[model samples]
Target chain A: MQLEVKPKGHTVFVYIKGEIDLQETERLRQEVDRYIDHHGMDHLVFDLTQVNFIDSSGVGGIIGRYRKMKDIGGKMSIVGAKPTVEKVLIFSGIQKIIPLYQTEKDRIKAEK
Target chain B: MNVNEKDFRVKNQIRLTIQSRAENVAFVRACTAAFASQMDYTLEEIDEIRLAVSEAVSNSIIHGYKNDPYSQVELYITLWENGGIEIVVEDHGCGIADLKQAMEPTFSTEPGRMGLGFAFMQSFMDQVEVKSRVGQGTTVILKRKVRQPVESKN
Candidate 1:
């Protein structure tokens, strides 16, 4: 997985691409947490348009990150998950708590 | 031998082994998705395959091995002629003490588990047969027919 950070005003957008499985869970968790701590960004957006697969472990990692961000008064939003990935997220009840946007533009708008 | 019936055909097979971790779920999903795509299965059929495979692998990991990497899960897949496919999932770990309870839809050894894995496989596939014994491990056999749908009467 690749993490690209784009700072647009006060919000920080994190773009994640590739399969987020158990193998990549630790790196992802650590990277996001480090970024949150380092930058002190209030708004976080995730781009999952290129992510093809995610399992329960991956979901757990994301949920963990969301919780950390939430605890620090930061907001996180996800954009562009394919149907398969979306199903797992929805089944795991992650979507109910996190707002999912259909496109990057919409996610940016929500961050505002 | 029937000379006309001797027309040649070829078969394909796929196999995978994964550790008993929640992480393996992605492998299962990717593999099942690839299989479905190769056979041009419909979206509904693809979802069914994903769910069934998930249950099969999850059962092997959770019940058979109990998250012990020392225990290994083996998966064998065969694509046969006449649009038939067979999947054999085996685990060498702690075996189920009661086959009946294990197959029950609501019976689960793991807390928060729905125990719908076997039931889901039965509902989605053409055939599902499980053979298991205490101290002998478990094997789940699943078969599905592609390119054809079971007809239902109105």
Candidate 2:
């Protein structure tokens, strides 16, 4: 998986493309954490439109990052997860914990 | 674990170039679930096997490769002759210093995560084996039996 970070004012947008499974979970977690720590951002959005699949570990990684952002008084949201990847997230109970947006524009609007 | 008269075996292989990270967990989950489905294993058994396989592969990418984007993780799965399964997870990365220490429950190289991958394998699978050497690489072998139990006449 590839994670690209874009700074939008006080929000850090993370655009991830590819499968979020055992192999990419750790790096993704570290990268997200690094961005949050470096920018001290209070809002985060993960773009998963290109993600083909996700698993428990991937779910755990996102949850882990979300908790980190939460503890620091930040908000987190997910945007554009494909059906299969989204199902895994839902199965892992991530949807219950994190809010999902229909589109990137919608996500940006929610951030406002 | 239980044993029954009828048994089946199947082998599946999937290889993809991945920039290793924690997200690989999902791939492992999907693959393992597909494997279990082919074997017709119960949901509980499938879930357990999925978790075990994910933990093993996660160790390979996280500890073995240390999240190197260029490296690849190879997974070979063999469903045995008697409703048993074995998975071989391999990675070309810096090998472990002490096998015993690495398998310890509290010996995680990363923070905020339990050093419990090895321990989880031991608890979840019937057998867990590791082969590694410094500067070479590492391969983790995991096996589990998934059959209905048979009662013997006394």
Whose lDDT is greatest here?
A: 2
CA-RMSD of model 2 = 7.9
Docking class of 1: incorrect
Task: Provide the fnat value for model 2, as a fraction from 0 to 1.
Answer: 0.29
lDDT of 1 by residue, B17-74 (tens): 8777756766776786676555546776676676667678778776888867656778
Residue B154 lDDT in candidate 2: 20
DockQ of candidate model 1: 0.11
DockQ of each: 0.11, 0.17
Candidate 1, A8-77: lDDT as tens digits:
8777777888777545766888888898888887778788898866654566678777888899998788
* lDDT digits (tens) for residues A1-112 of candidate 2: 7889998888788998876665577789888888787778878888998876555567768888889999999888999987656655665556777998779888768756
Q: What value does the lDDT take at residue B69 in candidate 2? A: 60
- Model 1 chain A: lowest-lDDT 10 consecutive positions: A52-61
Those runs of model 1 whose alpha carbons end farther than 4 Å from true positions after fitting are B1-38, B42-71, B80-84, B94-154
